[model samples]
Target: YEPSEDALQVEVDTKTIPHTEFLTYVFTDLSSTGATVALDWAKKQIPFKIEFDVSAIVLADIRQKLQGEAGFQRQNWEQAATFAMNNGGDLQEALGWINNAIEGQFFSSKTFNNMAVKAQILQKLGQKDKVLAMVPEMAGMANTNEMNNLGYMLVNMGENDLALKYFKINAKNNPANANVFDSLGEAYKIMGDRKNAIKNLKKSLSLNPPAGVKANSERLLAELGVVI
Candidate 1:
């Protein structure tokens, strides 16, 4: 069944809660296990607290499986994908599972983040034209995170012009997000626009990027002789 936007929102929110507590509640309050139980809880609860809890559970489960042994992780991911797809999980969930399977070396906190990033890089190396053709159609209809993902994809594909367009859109839409500025800088840098690159990179630094991103930006600045 195609879940409504509201239902999808409910799923996203529930997938954001702390995994342990969310799982405890699922086992205790819901008297069940697995994605079905979590999904059922999502369907039954009001769209407020319950949704948040379910989102947490889902995220936690994904993280756990990602961190496990590689073979086990792949198996679990396939199982999760199959379960989610068969049981009315949305396209986002299915795609997320597939991504998880692709991002190797066991799961870890950064698996999905790294996968998204790496995919963006690969698209740059081999799929620039295709990515440029697809991103605009995906922009508004896709979730914000996924849209940001598309932005990364565009950047990696060396479609800096197109990537900047999406980054600017995301930055305007989410002014508080520092990563948008960082991504914008990368796009500009690729375009050989050092001035704007430095400016946006500074903005990204000001926002206190995640450690990995901060280091990367610093390295890039150093390479450019920007002396940040």
Candidate 2:
């Protein structure tokens, strides 16, 4: 394994030991739990190799074990949920894991974050009403700064429409804040709504925002060929 290159080169002499035989032996020895355990052990043995190149069967085994052991722990459940979501192989399974994380604890710190992930999963699953239902809770939990950051984060992730949703929420909640409108404008611009972008950016500037906020609004307006 080359640490700098991040590549694992396995050399085997086919004359002395056939490649097929080696693979067969490895597979036979490392079945379900065995493969998972070996991967875990390898992570400990090999520094810089956080993830292993294992089969889907081994990953499924690990996920199953994690779910079974998650019992009442918000972080554990959230971790399992995140892993399932990142897997992207089964949206229903990801939804189940995130639901488990959300319901595991009544007053957990991870509850809101879990809800956000659930909303994303729901959106992917085409559950628009359910995703919309979560907006109040998510928006209520987030402050102006947090909401602004989240909206931009979604924009960076190319989720412009979803980002627009949060930006609208922030503008509604913090009507007096110039930054909120600025963020809303940026989201609208990314969503290709030039009219709304100009409207909100103009609103932001009119609010007498700080220099940075004023400059950003002006810049966006300039990009849209509107010098307001």
Task: Please list the C-alpha lDDT of all candidates, in the order they appear.
Answer: 0.60, 0.70
Query: Quick one: best TM-score, which candidate?
Result: 2
Q: Model 1's lDDT to the true fold? A: 0.60
* Number of colliding residue pairs in each model: 14, 0
Clashing pairs in 2: none
Worst 10 residues of 1 by lDDT: 42-51
